[model samples]
Target: METAQNQQQAVCGKEALDLLNCVAQSPYDQEKCVALLQSLRQCVLNKKVKKFSLAEPHKEQADSSMIWSKTETWKWSTKLSH
Candidate 1:
């Protein structure tokens, strides 16, 4: 049982890593990379590593919102100072 579990983990890791490499190689292929990332996320969930949450529908949206908010705050601060 332990060996089987280890093998499954190894396979999942390999698949995720391969997808990452694909994204790295084709940086301009945004759609493909996003699909790969979603697949990787699904793989992790299948391994019971995380729980599904509606708060984070897409990986990019979650990260971009934080970044956008920070940029907006900085802009406001700069304007206030000027």
Candidate 2:
């Protein structure tokens, strides 16, 4: 069940990114794109994706490369001990 939810979140994120790319490629539809962007943001917030953490399991090592940080960026380091 958790895996399914994660997959759903991935789909939503990809769709939002695709919409953003389309907006970037075509500036004439800024209004519509902005509306869609806001909707996507709200959806993500409601789902708490922005609050996701490294504690969550990732399918690939590359997917765990970066972690969200308030002060600085984080990158997975094989050399560092946890």
Candidate 3:
């Protein structure tokens, strides 16, 4: 069970990383990252991933202002409008 969970996390993590890299490389033109973003969204839905941590939290950082901060936990909204 743990192995399966790890594999799912890996898949979603890879997709997310790819999207992040795409956005970083093309900050001015975000259109290029659209496909990558969609891919990550699809992976999240397919894997049924509710929440995932990008990095470990630091003791000093108590602010939750940054959306992509190391302490923030990303959650995927399952409700999609059709």
Candidate 4:
């Protein structure tokens, strides 16, 4: 069976791939690119919103879940930074 560590690594890899795809699909669309990154960032921010250090340890993992939002994601990122 795959361990937690393996699962974490898989999540990380997927996030990286997703980010690459996001950029690849919108090469010339600044808004789309920004939106993609912001959405990814939001997934990270939501999980660690309780912390004040702005440190996201399992950010990639949390962001890779199927429940990830495509909309209002940037707004969540804003919540993390604030």
Candidate 5:
């Protein structure tokens, strides 16, 4: 079970990295990153990725990753619509 979870994390991590790199390369162009963003979103849904954290396991390292769940994404979108 743990192995399967780790695999999923690896896939999601790759997708996240791809999207970040795309955005970094084209900061002013939202259109360019749309496909990569969608790819990451699909991976997140398919893998049931609940959250992502940094590699450092040490408690001293600050975890700055913006962890979000499905509900949180929904709430954020709804706020934008209002």
Candidate 6:
């Protein structure tokens, strides 16, 4: 499912700022909204491009370089032939 943030163009970072403002004034969900805004801010500071811009697709060059391994492969003797 696409989040409201992921569905938009990230126009001038306005959506993020708007979320923060809304959270400040919110009654029932103020904590949740504030937490999300803080998390967004932290992601950007961490240089986490994936979290920074969810709408953008992954770059093939970067994706191709990453190595992934499932935990079962290392713990168990079983290995798929194909």
- Evaluate all candidate structures by whole-model CA lDDT and list the values in order: 0.43, 0.48, 0.54, 0.44, 0.52, 0.40
At residue 29, what lDDT does model 6 achieve? 80
The candidate that wins on lDDT is: 3
Candidate 3 collision pairs: none
In terms of lDDT, model 4 sits at 0.44
TM-score of 1: 0.42
Cα-based TM-score, every candidate: 0.42, 0.42, 0.51, 0.35, 0.50, 0.28
Candidate 1 lDDT, tens digit per residue, 31-58?
8778888886777666654322222332
The clash numbers for all candidates, in the given order, read 0, 0, 0, 0, 0, 0
Per-model RMSD to reference: 15.6, 10.2, 7.9, 11.2, 10.8, 17.0
lDDT of 2 by residue, 1-82 (tens): 5674353344235446555565766445877777787876776666555432343333344433433334655432122112
Q: Whole-model lDDT for model 3 versus the true structure?
A: 0.54
lDDT: worst 10-residue window of model 6? 72-81
Model 6 stretches astray by more than 4 angstroms: 1-8, 11-18, 24-28, 48-82
Window of ten residues with lowest summed lDDT in model 1: 73-82
* Order of quality (lDDT): 3, 5, 2, 4, 1, 6
> Per-residue CA lDDT of candidate 3, range 4-79, in tens?
4453334366677677767667345577688888988898788776665433443232221122443555432222
RMSD of 3: 7.9
Q: After superposition, how far is residue 30 of candidate 1 from its true place, in Å?
A: 1.0
Of candidates 5 and 3, the better by TM-score:
3
Stretches > 4 Å off in candidate 5: 1-9, 57-82
Highest TM-score against the true fold, candidate:
3
Put down candidate 4 lDDT per residue, 20-44, tens digits, no spaces: 5666663467776677677656766
lDDT tens digits, residue span 1-82, model 6: 9785344323224435556456656375877777767765664455433332222223332212211123321111111122
Model 5, C-alpha of 39: deviation from truth (Å): 0.7
